[model samples]
Target chain A: MNDTNYTPSVAYLGPEASFTHIAAAELFGHKGLTPRPTIPDCIEAVTEGHVAYAVVPLENALEGSVPLTIDYLFHGGELFITAEISTPIGQHLMVNKAQKDFTDQLESIQSHPHALAQCHKFLQYRYRKIPLIQTTSTAAAAKYISEQPALHIAAIGNQLAAETYGLHIVEENIHDFHFNHTRFVVLSLRKEILDHKNHAASKKTTLMVKLPEDDKAGMLHQILSVFSWRRLNLSKIESRPLKTGLGHYFFIIDVNESEDHPMMKGAMEELAALGCTARSFGSYYVYETDPSSE
Target chain B: MNDTNYTPSVAYLGPEASFTHIAAAELFGHKGLTPRPTIPDCIEAVTEGHVAYAVVPLENALEGSVPLTIDYLFHGGELFITAEISTPIGQHLMVNKAQKDFTDQLESIQSHPHALAQCHKFLQYRYRKIPLIQTTSTAAAAKYISEQPALHIAAIGNQLAAETYGLHIVEENIHDFHFNHTRFVVLSLRKEILDHKNHAASKKTTLMVKLPEDDKAGMLHQILSVFSWRRLNLSKIESRPLKTGLGHYFFIIDVNESEDHPMMKGAMEELAALGCTARSFGSYYVYETDPSSE
Candidate 1:
């Protein structure tokens, strides 16, 4: 499986035609792709040596971070992020081909909770009386709608789902905000991928830091002071529970520099001196989806 | 509707027996409690004057922040946090009474995604081949299992759900971790509740701040410096996208001081001087659920 002649297999969170699937396609092209039912399954596939790589959503511009992905990476196991991909999210109203007048025949809409929330204004204004059913994923909802023979049912999902499930797009771009985007990370058990020259050229490092048990006044500020004094730019900062009890959290920071950078190294050493444990996941380049390719 | 003789109505996110319902009951004690079908619906019920107060989950001990609640509070409307409640979460595996041997007869387990994830270890070890179905809520799953006459179906939910739906608890405490808890906030449009003596003595304030259009290095550090210099303790800090674009975000900080405190007032003024806009939600005491009362 480690031979260069072997076809590399990639896993993603999917029921097919999911946003994660689109991100995986953007990164791997038409190579061997496997769709896993959940985030954990996708990562497990990589850890268990069934796949060479796994792609999972890290955060969304509109909805914030994906909790499952972050929690698993922080506490569940040790998997390094090899690369990053950012894709623009476009949600559409999909229905069976027999449904012509959606407004008149639309009895209920089915979709993932996030998709329904993203199209809040459109749903409230048009189908105020109808109910909204929750599904595991937008792609799952599209598959369900395609399998049904009802005219009053529809789903809110991406264009890829409509195409894959043989549904017709009744309306396009129904999301409340036009600038929705999701960031996905490529995870792999192989350390060689992180040491690749192409990945090293991109100066971005993500670190997970856990502060001292005694959280005194100005403790967080002290940790931030290390990076502030060095003038290292931080692109994002998020906190997740340690799961020990209430009020216990660990911080994840994305810095605009590589792990080997002198400033980042100094900051990490200073943080360790201040009773903080910091671990660098990896340094990787982010690839933006090209509109022309889509 | 605002008369003294009127019995105020309260709303919670529910199809009944939800965690939000339990929080609402602990606060209102069965006084005019109404169950809203969704988080947005519960908030809208209060905003439209249909209900006097709404109870919604803010964060979980294991799952971190509830993105829907945070996003709605940040961008949806003008509701303010009047009070806070913390409830212990206890999950149970429930089955219909007719099913005596669930280990052999169980074909599917239905639950909300969070509930399913929390009970991952139990499900995987005991019934590896059973299909897990996703529902809108844990309470909804319990209701569905109760209504069906099939012995092959089961649900993972709270004890209240088991009792409410007349199901038998096959196993208790099925969650992966023991210390599971969720923080709920009481939202209201009325200002008189915040002026009460009990709420004024809590001395905890939550502030939402939006940085200037140009995000520069060390800007967040400067904002934290205002509180650090005064020796004010900070409980939590979270960032959410401003919906403007991919790189823009606004910060939400929880300070261990009242909004009217001189130190907090000075911090807000200094933050404003540094090109940031801050709004105080409120100061209130947190009530922990009493096991004996339940």
Candidate 2:
């Protein structure tokens, strides 16, 4: 029997112990979080009314953007971003407790491709000969290592994953860069929730703008001038393929203004007048999760 | 014993039959193409003088930019883009030849994440219940299916991979989109080759520009104006994190002009005056591989 009376359920990209899991726990606590296998499944759960919200990683400091997440939001389905959570990523080299001398006998390492790549320097310098296995997620890697109980095999994951899978940390802060962080966004099908949650002072509005198909000089510059002339800060800009053909792209820009801001609306109007179509994906406040809490 | 005098060696991302392998063969045939395990290895092989050139995917029409390749060229090592090759990606559903009628008992499908994602619609529609296994490369997936023949196992990869690994094509053109293509670039250490090979009329110059640390309104607009005022055509523009902190990024722009072009040099000089730094990654010719030849 399904119990929906207690708390609202949230779906996150997971097998439990993923970075998205930590992000979901950070925002909504650990009680009503459901671990979904893929990004689409997590998002679809919200759209299909199976969950109240879905938390998925949007971007990483090291890896520019999660392509699947960006693609899905830009073109796949109709879901609005309600809020964002930033988590400090700390990748650890973890192994089974029985494998005490992991460095001496470590035959192979496993992790998601991004995690493996973040810690590439350490692996190359210390264990060049060891093979690296790729998994769907870092949590999956930790789960696999815990279940297999193989000697000389380890995984690169976060502290939450290590604890969830009953693995010991072989090395801490294994990622190459110290400022590693990932930003996860909360998505929901209901527009009322997004509209009601825009009271926070610190907000950002995201827009997907497709320029005219014709090759016009200074067209992209003109689009940026709409925001710059208003003196509104532009935080991020990324180009995604329009998928119509080669060399065709639509730009996704994040402006430091809420949807309710008059300037933001005016800019969108001006962009439209210049033969560009803009789709606003709602505005949301960003909350940074404290590393000390973890 | 190695034969160095016979042919110049080239490294590609490989375990024998990767798309990069196809790109390498497209450029240099199959004889001197050495298969390296990872992108870094392939790039490093050229930088370390072990090979003459390294072929790696830069971007896919559907997948946007290849983060690892972009990051490495932007921040990792000293290498120049000498040439660019465009390859048409054709994903095929392959199975072991001996295992006929695999669809009836299809238990699992395997491929590189990108390949799998590109064919998500087909997989979800036809084999909804089958488990999808992630492999290092699509070529590796085909090879695995060939070596360890299973009744219900299939792989998604290119036609060359099916031929290389001796697998039978169960279905051709399995990808969801028909115009799927990947752009591969040749990375080399010598600047002379890049300069001498720029005679082709169709060339593109790439520049990495870092904005000022202090946030200023209209600064990005000013930078774009430099390119726009000169009537220069930008083929592509992407922002990559500088890894210093969140919201800090450096832009990589591809201009339709050679590095030696007078207007391009003027644009770079003006960008410098605006408290920004620009690094040129050289101009290279683009060659499209004819699908009919394959």
Candidate 3:
């Protein structure tokens, strides 16, 4: 929801140097905002009115869907997607200032496994058969390596993490894909951020729908048919099994338009008749691509 | 293709304690399998002609997509999906045998961040706000905590990891859902096994297509239109952006018909004319529901 009077301070799922922090930073970059730790904490902050808003990662270009983000949106109706931000995630081969040029051209390649996987080609082409140590975070890897200078290790991390941990950017953008971007959703109590920004007018809206436990396949068909019947476009749909094991499934949907339309209203109504939990992430916006570069 | 005469050795992503290992074990439960140490190794094993099939994760019940599996499928057409297996995943709270009981319950709760998030509810319900330590693997956490017994530290992992490391199950099924499954696909060099199991007449086939470096939306439409054009049932469609960067996307499609049909042949021809790479994974008998469980 748009709060014209206040600059929204959003909470993100984090531990100081998480990608969620990066997402929050990008979401609030134009507005100059700060982020709190943890997605649930972010949801709680929004619910308790500690901050004007919160931002969390709904999906990643490489990893696909994020379930906790979907689950929180499905369960917590207090916050809605005010805007969306997509940032190109070009990870790096960062090292502590102490580690110099490689003698073997390869030491230990330390990083979060996901980061390691994203830079799979680089590691394979360069190291081939060297040890790949998994760290909790890129920051954690950098942090640990900063203390163990003699260990001869290079950590794959973000630019910010390298700078923060006094590490040098030994190699830039080691990820397999140069155009990696993680998409984030800005959440707020107000459901109408679209009108204020004029920025989100052309943006997409994300909806989370919880499917009924009984006859799962049939229920999925009925819900999908609603979108089909209306000729409404769905950009993405991710099915996440509800963790409570109640046999219910949650579908995180990204549509090309807002929830204000008659067709969308009808779709939601039909969705409700199916006897399931359906909630909107309100008005969301995604980034325009830099065609020549990206 | 299936090789009915020869039992092939297989490579999968895992250490003995990994969920990947559990999936590999279950998928090859009836038949013996040799598990590889890593997914890259698995891919390499198949590429080097050491193994006929490699089992890799396509998607998780909680997470939407697994990109590397798709990347390998796209990069190497020499492999095809032979068997699809779904393995149940449930997080467990384990403690060293020496530390029989948690003193303060949780001076700390250790796990991979994913496991921590998956059992967020159980953690919040069980303990007060305590430090949650993230490790590379749940098994790593179990091994660490088991080797260094602490009163209030409990590790979250699988039963196998806990038992192997001489840890007791402090809490069972700590995952968010009961039906949590990671889908695994077996890639083979030839379609021999399926052909052996198939009758003289059979109906479905799996195909992998690498769309041109152009309009992604248009490609998805054309891919979908082919099945809709033939009135063929399109069951599953998954897309992975190719590693080569912008506009290049790889799609995996499952159709309820054989390639022998002229309509299907024409559709394949049309798809090929669009300047895309397509390869068939052959046709095989499949049960939507697990036959043994059913």
Candidate 4:
């Protein structure tokens, strides 16, 4: 399984045509892609040596962080984020081909809760009276709607889902915000590996830092001070519950520098000297989805 | 209603016996407590003058922040936090009275997905084969189980929910963790007010701060630098999607100081000078739940 010469397969959270499937295809091409039912399953597939890597949603622009992915990285096995992929999310109103002409008379709308919530404005303005059912995923909704062509049900999902399920796109880009995007991370047992065709556009080193138990005043500021003076640029800063109790949190800082950089190393060393436990989640290369290829 | 002198009824997010209901009852008396179907409904009840205030959960120790409450505060109508309530979360396994003696032979378990996820370990160990149903809330599950007397369905909810629905608790504190807590905020048109019997145990000022559009390097550090120099202790710092695009976020910072304090005021001014837009969400006094009273 550790054949560095030959990269095997990759697993993603999916039932085919889900966002993770799209991301996995974009990263590893259409070959040897396995769709796991859940995020945990995808991650376990990698750790259990079923696949060379796993791709899962890390965060969304409108919905914020994916807790399962973050929690897995924080508390689960020894997996590292080997690569980062950012893709623009385009949600469409898809219906079965049998009822394509009767788009206005939808019996019900279905999608993942987040997707339904994303298209909330459109749905409220148009299909306000129609019931919105929550499914396990966008693809699941699309599959259900496709399976029951007699039922006039619409699904809010990506274009791939409509194509995969033989559905027609009734409306395009129904999402409330045009700026919706989801960030996916490639998790691998080994670090600093990109088995895909795309080259690295940039680099980011994510560090999970926990301050000393006695949260003294300005402790977080001091932690920031370590990187502030060194001129390390931070792309994102997020705090997650330590799960111990209220008022306890650990910061996930994404620094715009490679882990091997002197400044990054010095900052981690300084954090330790200040009695903070800092772990480098990963130093991964950032890649953007090729719109032309899609 | 402009009747600041005369306190009116309050609205809370509830299907009866929910955590918000418990928090509302803890803050206000049992009288004049209206239960709204949703968080937005509760907030709207206050804004539309149906109620004087709305009590909604802001954050949970395990699940993190409640986006609906935060979004309403940031983007919705004019509202201010008048009071804050912190309550311990105790999840219990409850069954209908008819099946009280057959707890071990339960057919299914139902709860809000968050509640179900919280009690994942207990459910897996005891009744792994039981089908888990997702309800809108834990109280909803309790209500449903109570209504269906013939079904051997159990609900994992609070003690109040079990008592309210006349259900028997088969297991107490079934949640995997013991340090779970939820912070609920009392939203009102007027600020610095507490309409309850309990006095303020502590004070906190929450600020919603956004960095300039250019997002210069170390801009966040500069923002923190203002409070760092003043030695303002921050209880929590969370970043939410600005809903514009990726790599953009506005932070919700909870500082352990009154908004009127000079240090706090100076920090806002400094932030303003640093090309940051900062708004004081509220300067509310925090009240701890009286466990003995419950």
Docking class of 1: acceptable
lDDT of 3 by residue, B4-106 (tens): 4666577776655666656555545425466554455577788778887787777653321365556556666677666665567768787777777554556
B130-242 per-residue lDDT for model 1 (tens digits): 99987767888999988886668999988778889999888888877655567788899874343322222455778898989886988888888989999998888877777
* DockQ of all models, two decimals each: 0.47, 0.43, 0.22, 0.36
**Clash pairs for candidate 1:** none
Can you tell me which runs of candidate 4 are displaced by over 4 Å? A1-18, A29-55, A60-72, A128-140, A147-153, A290-294, B1-18, B28-57, B60-72, B101-112, B128-155, B188-192, B289-294
Better of 2 and 3 by DockQ: 2
CAPRI grade, predicted model 4: acceptable
How far out, in Å, is residue B106 in model 4?
A: 4.7
Candidate 2, residues B1-294, lDDT tens digits: the string is 034356668998766877777777776667878977556667778988999888887875222226667876778648888888787778889999877665668889998666776677788789889998867568778888888775679999888888888888888888766655677888888763333221346678888999998848778788999999999988778777777877788888888888888998899899999899888888888777777644
Isolated chain B TM-score per model: 0.89, 0.89, 0.78, 0.92
- What is the DockQ score, from 0 to 1, of model 2? 0.43
Q: For each candidate, what TM-score against the reference?
A: 0.91, 0.90, 0.80, 0.84
List clashing residue pairs in candidate 4. none
lDDT of 2 at B95: 91
By DockQ, the best candidate is 1
How are the candidates ranked when ordered by TM-score, highest leading?
A: 1, 2, 4, 3
Instruction: Write model 4 residue lDDT over A1-294, tens digit each, in one string.
Output: 234466469997766898878777876777789886555667778987889889888875222226546765776648888988877788899999999998878889988655776676687688879988866568878999999989888998987898899999989888766655678989888876574555565678888999899878888888888988999988888777777766788888889898899988899999999999999877887777865443
